[model samples]
Target: MQDTLSNKALLKATVIAVFIAGLALVSFILPAEYNIDPTGIGAKLGLTALANPKAAVVSGAETKATIDVPKSVQAADIIEVIIPAGRGLEFKFAMEKFKKMEYQWQTDGAAIFFDLHGEPEGDTTGYYESYAIATLADMQGSFTTPFAGVHGWYWKNKSAQAVVITLTVSGEYSVIGLKK
Candidate 1:
């Protein structure tokens, strides 16, 4: 009889321990980085003010324009690309596409971060959205047009210093929304 009681108690303890461990895994052990807000500050992630690329320039011999974005940025966010006409690198050198602009998507800010390295590896072309989702050191092709509008922004980095990109819009931009 004593042996039976002992066995039952052991089983119960084992079950309890297993349950607690499972809870911990879900709450703390899992990767909650992609999680986002359902509804808080901004309205539905919708169309925002268009970015005037002609209003600014990503210049300097080694001046790279870096833009950081929160991971919450969904596919509907507006990512305006503005390359204002200035005394920046001429179309020849400026036309080169950068092999590494280094970019990332964040949930805390749903921000897109990157830098505009010296000469580009190629040209960045077409319309893109915000959170146009890309990872660090993982990018392809180049941008041709001076101005572009995407759902989100992303880039690759090949430089040494981790550049922090800031979007200096000519107008107010919209906030990004993450999946609920």
Candidate 2:
């Protein structure tokens, strides 16, 4: 009968849809989104770069970026900050265009979300350029200022315990401490 044929066709369509979804998950979604390609097809097809797209970024592990130590670091300042549990904080520096800074920061064994960014001086549009954003415990690198502004980091602690952040930096800029 026509009714039976329609039912059978619907079942076949459902099965085909499910199969395609599963295959896409294994082939594209897992590799492109999470960088976990169990079948190695993602790597072969160059889908792994879709994971973070940020250079020297770490999601859940420590990835250290080595930067050349500049002579300006002779006046480097090491600041220790304690971020309360389940809170966030911002620390920054005032620098001119084309200036450079070498820095490193680390948390007390807990991973946290961090956004390294810069906001141009006297901008009221809430415009900020993020250099990197990642969830990790430690990172180190040298950064050259792109434009005159306040450049620094905003770290958010998501754990129940307080996190102590020790940051050391040397640069051609003034420190605009935590409450700036």
TM, every model: 0.22, 0.59
Error of 2 at 92 (Å): 0.8
Clashes of 1: 49
Model 2: lDDT of residue 74: 33
lDDT of 2 by residue, 115-147 (tens): 999999899999999999999999999899999
List the lowest-lDDT window of 10 residues for candidate 1: 87-96
Off by over 4 Å in 1: 1-5, 32-66, 70-180
Using lDDT as the measure, which candidate wins? Answer: 2
**Candidate 1 residue-wise lDDT, 61-120, digit = tens:** 333322233232222222223222221121111111211122222221222233332322
